[model samples]
Target: MSHPHPELTTPPPLPENGLRVVALGGLGEIGRNMTVLETKGRLLIVDCGVLFPEDHHPGVDLILPDFSYVQDRLDDVEAIVLTHGHEDHIGAVPYLLRLKGDIPLIGSTLTLALVEAKLKEHRIRPFTLAVREGQRERVGAFDLEFVAVNHSIPDALAVFVRTEAGTLLHTGDFKMDQLPLDGRITDLRAFARLGEEGVDLFLTDSTNADMPGFTTPELEIAPAIDKVFRHAQRRIIVACFSSHVHRVQQVLDAAAKAGRKVAFVGRSMIRNMGIAADLGYLHVPDGILVDIKRLGDLRDDELVLISTGSQGEPMAALSRMANGDHRINVGPGDTVLLASSLIPGNENAVYRVINGLMRLGAAVVHKGNAKVHVSGHASAGELLYCYNIVRPRNVMPVHGEWRHMFANAQLAIQTGVPERNVVLAEDGVVVDLVDGHASITGVVDCGYIYVDGTNIGGTDEALLKDRRILRDEGFITCIVVLDAATGKIASGPEITARGFVESEEIFQQVIPKVERAIEEAVANGVRDDQQLQQVIRRAVGSWVGGKIRRRPMIIPVVLQA
Candidate 1:
């Protein structure tokens, strides 16, 4: 399955000067993440991700990195390493498989399981090379070590990359939660050991660098959920990310404390629980897992439904419940809790689901209404704390927007990191590391690939421009017939317009004037295709502008035959 776009005949060449780290994505934004470490003629890619586009982007599903620069050099590329199973970090696997499916993928057992599920869902079966915490592996010229990191999701890690030039610590999303539901905490001693061994360059997450304060512990939400379960007279439904094993444990614990039977609704939630239980990450009490089909037989107060669609994904269980399509409907007596923040650009979809759930007569609780959800990323204070712990010679902030990157860079400076030591990066900008000193080396051909339907192609700025025009003033199509032999008008010129005019009567009054303009263009003896099309376009545009008092996109179909 080849990508729709032309594959790069050659992968990007190694920097002629020294070791360089290139950020393909996750530098300026939250998703579609990728980072490249180039040294000794080898490249190790860390976490390929996809960014979900804004609502106004019609027909676009996601924004991916253009892999043309690395397509030709798939051999020099060692392995695709995953830090966690978040979509922004792993969503590009299918897209990458379509381009070069043979590359080995390395991650922890849980991350591999999630990726396997995603691959099966997409009908892609690529061979995986799974790794666990404390494991060391080699790919090309780079030696990789996986260090367990505490996060909202299971099996999140901070990758330690060793190259001939130096050692780089790529911290994936992490927090310092000592009492996480999973009982796995970040290996700070290991990071401290690495610091003692010496870190040449440090690339860390900056998603919360702008905020101030430590990330709340995951256990804090258990009491809130317990209150909901205890006070609710009817059934209780909790919606969240299916991969958050810690949060899942919290929900199950809360349900058990409230003496309610738990039933998993979404496939993702079920699969993750199965993995967590098998791996001993989740400690669900025996005989508490009830089937969803048996829900009607249970008392309302005894049932606690754990489901998915925290981001308001349309096909997930929560969305189906909101639309009244689920087998169990939330009546006036049920209490529904949204246990996650709406990912940016998904606000509209989240709001729609909320509206639908409210219409179904269920009480809804979210971040603002209740303390049901907390962010996984570190806040400003936590970011400063991590900076103080590592105390790298040079700091590169990745995984945030431009503003976030800048703010985080400032925070790094404030946290005793010298101003010169902080480097704010964007996609394709290469920061060269020479003997523990860093500087901008050069740029790479890094940009976004828009996925629209089955076709993956470069998003044209012109198309967006035309879409903006259509959004503002609508569109009008003008068809004109000109005599090929004598360059004269032959038949009646027709104007077909939609979304611009309210009624056919308005179009009828506007058509003749449009025809007269076309006749004038023919009378002026325009013969060339470009000239004729331009003339017709301008004439129709002017007429529509005068009538509607707006400039509609005028598409001219000129026929000579």
Candidate 2:
């Protein structure tokens, strides 16, 4: 059923000479942060991104935005703007560039470097333009200004956009961290200036809106990490987001202070930190960085391992180490520090890995046990501060789940923005702003484009259902050789089952029953291949569902001989 938008009568088309904001994703979910800004016959994209798969989305590698809305409108797209380097904000660039390889891309220095590296992975070379905070550039019908913001990564930015229709400010994922490691704080002064200039619509990150108080500064973790490093008698393994350069800096500082040589573990952690360090976003002390292969040469107390898989990804280095599959095996007396919060939906996997590490006699410290990690999003108090400073006429919450968006909107209301002015937009809902008034004018097809292995959107709902049935209850296949003209069984009926029966004896006992059902369907005057197959499938499904109390996928194959 279509969600009824009482105010929106028709599909939210691009407004005529008015500004409209369309969330491609990242409204009802935590990741895949994309939005479309349209006005003056020109379109600008903000944050084309992807979502990591949950446990239920088995076999799905990545999920992308349905870029179809912009497919026909590509000519109108002036440039694709990136706010930061996080995967949820930049991961889909390669996918988008696959459609239009020459589209102009804009982002801060570190952000663009990360994007370029990612694009190179897909053999894509796109026209690129770099922008920095306090600088302004004109892109087609929109004037873009980059304002500095503090996040987990360096060189984060918020785009201040001026178009023919109105002035819009998009705050990418940010937090009011006064003591950021890089000394590049979120530009409150710039925000004040934007407020004075008058913002028509304000789009802010809603990831931490429900959490009270401001996010803890990046510097706050140094002491805690220092404590961990000081206490660890053997190797200290730290897991964090690869793109979190500030956190990496802290880990490096702690390791250095503790006289431990640091070796980056995980491919992405090595690559990204190398990029950041070369770009001056990260500072590595002389002789402190060691190659991973040489980690065994150093004494346990002299080594520190920093890796990825802070979210407990199965193949990540930390997980491999916990399972004793990594080259540098960790065991008794080792301390594994998870320097990241548990992302929603990853709790089970993360906890399971943590338990595995503990079972291996390694001490584990995470957010629950230590203040080693801080959220990179603005919390309730920080959002209130942003709302008060920008004082935008219309507020649109972005970059979080539904509850987080709603919570952020309520904060906007508390900051004196009218309840009517706050637009709670989900993925695909279009909010149009005119004369400083914002309303839901339309919506578009904003569905997921899943990436499975080498294919995009390869797993449809039916395929997923079949996979679920195969996983949960196993599957049964029935093959019958039939006489083409007489519609009579010519040879035999063979039944096979997988994941259903444990032993050959049990399977043999079930195969005869399934073969009998196929014969019964054939004798019931089922002639057409399609008809007989359906009948056999249903008969086998019902019989097994009753006998085994399971509903496996019943596949029937009618081969006329």
Candidate 3:
């Protein structure tokens, strides 16, 4: 299999009739999915999305795919074709639109609705085209065909792109859920037909390739959720991804069966579900749905609150409720069902929320203890079936971490795809299709662009390192006053610390070192305030590192008094 190499030079240039495929993100990770296709000097983008921050991200709100690769060529982009409505598939639409609004967005009905609603919040008006399964649209030099696919959400699609160079099929996140809740199964007949028509390159979702079997059908979750509703003695709280309309629908069905009224919590949950209901994707019984404000009027047993934060995002509703920070106090007699799989890197945060809820006398049920959730991506068995059916000339894995992609690549090879035809690449790796063959050509600048509050792409690694130090260690400041005429110490050398467990008296030991260091620097004719501050900083930093073994952020201030 071909792998990205550090030595690979910049791709020479797309051949006159060749198609260039480059992933800006989502090859080695589960989110921040974007891929750029170039043919005839025109660009076609598939899925602009965001990656949620983890512990290491500190103050970051979201991570975007660096758009620098396309900043100069935004006008060349014909349209961004969305495969689904999931956050990881469309969350970054608003940000990308901010760069150059008026770029047309193409997706299914619900997908377009969700993105338009989100874009409305950002005050961006986007031009959009809504297409359904089996529909075809010619945009620029690319002929796009949308095929129905079943996933956790409704109206998911796999795109078939035809260019002069070759035919490529990009399967956005999907599963072969034979009995999807919405009665839409992944269109394998279309895959077989496309295989007969010769798919030159196949880009597949690798998120579940490591799993050994087909993904469990979404229909199976209803029984488990019904059991939870039947056994709960008091109020029920179900936490899931806001965009998971099917799961929310399951919760509604369970609540209706149990004779309970449901209230949607969290702004995202309410907005997304509202859109789904209006679009006919989420069906709610007339009397079973109640406003969150009326939650107080109903008895505990007659209520169900569906909310966000199954991933344990700090600001999400379920997390706030778990930490006793939300108005909806979750305590005794409440059963909180985490109706979603724990995303990688979010285990600790999810566990912390679970522990807090349990400490407050609430019973917690998750995928570990209950069958409340199933993966949205197809597993190894399904991938093998897809490989056998599609039988594409070349295969590339997308939308997963390294291991998942590796596993998917192996599956493709096991199904008779030449080992040489499987391309295993990470984000930023460039692949080109020329003469009916796909190969890695080069790499590009694909870095994480951080979003903090209203700022976009403003925070870099250095800022994150400082934030980590402040959060994990502590902060210390040293103040020294100097005599302008003599270049000598004029007044006190004071040290103060915050976020440290050490007492103020403990810092007294380092104060002497700080004074001596400043005096020595001054005596040596280092009169520059910056130079003097550096000396003091080094002295105090060494003392703290040697004594306390902590590397907190150290600030040194020198003033001529």
lDDT of 2 at 239: 92
* Residue-level lDDT tens digits of model 1 in 1-561: 001123323234545545778788887777989987888877788998889876566657788987876788777877889999888999888888776677788998878787877888778887788887788988878888889898888789999888878788999988777677677888888887777777777788887777677888887887788777778888889898887777778878888877889999888789878877887778898778899889888999898898998777777899999998888787888888889877766888988988899898888888878788777887888777777777777888889887777877888788787777777767877677877777665577887788877778756656766777888778887676778897766764677777764764576676666566656766786577677778777776676677678887888777886
Better of 1 and 2 by TM-score: 2
User: Which run of 10 residues does model 2 get worst, by summed lDDT?
Assistant: 1-10
Higher-ranked by TM-score: 2 or 3: 3
Selected candidate, larger lDDT, 1 vs 2: 2
Task: State residue 407's C-alpha deviation in candidate 1, in Å.
Answer: 2.3
Per-model TM-score, in order, reads: 0.89, 0.95, 0.99
Worst 10 residues of 3 by lDDT: 514-523
* Candidate 1 wrongly placed segments (more than 4 Å): 1-17, 121-127, 290-302, 320-331, 458-461, 464-473, 483-490, 528-531, 546-551
What candidate 3 gets wrong by more than 4 Å, as runs, is: none
Ranking by TM-score: 3, 2, 1
Candidate rank order under lDDT: 3, 2, 1
State residue 263's C-alpha deviation in candidate 1, in Å. 3.8
Candidate 2 lDDT tens digits, 166-229 = 8999999999999888889999999999999999999989999999988888777888998898
Number of the predicted model whose lDDT against the real structure is largest: 3
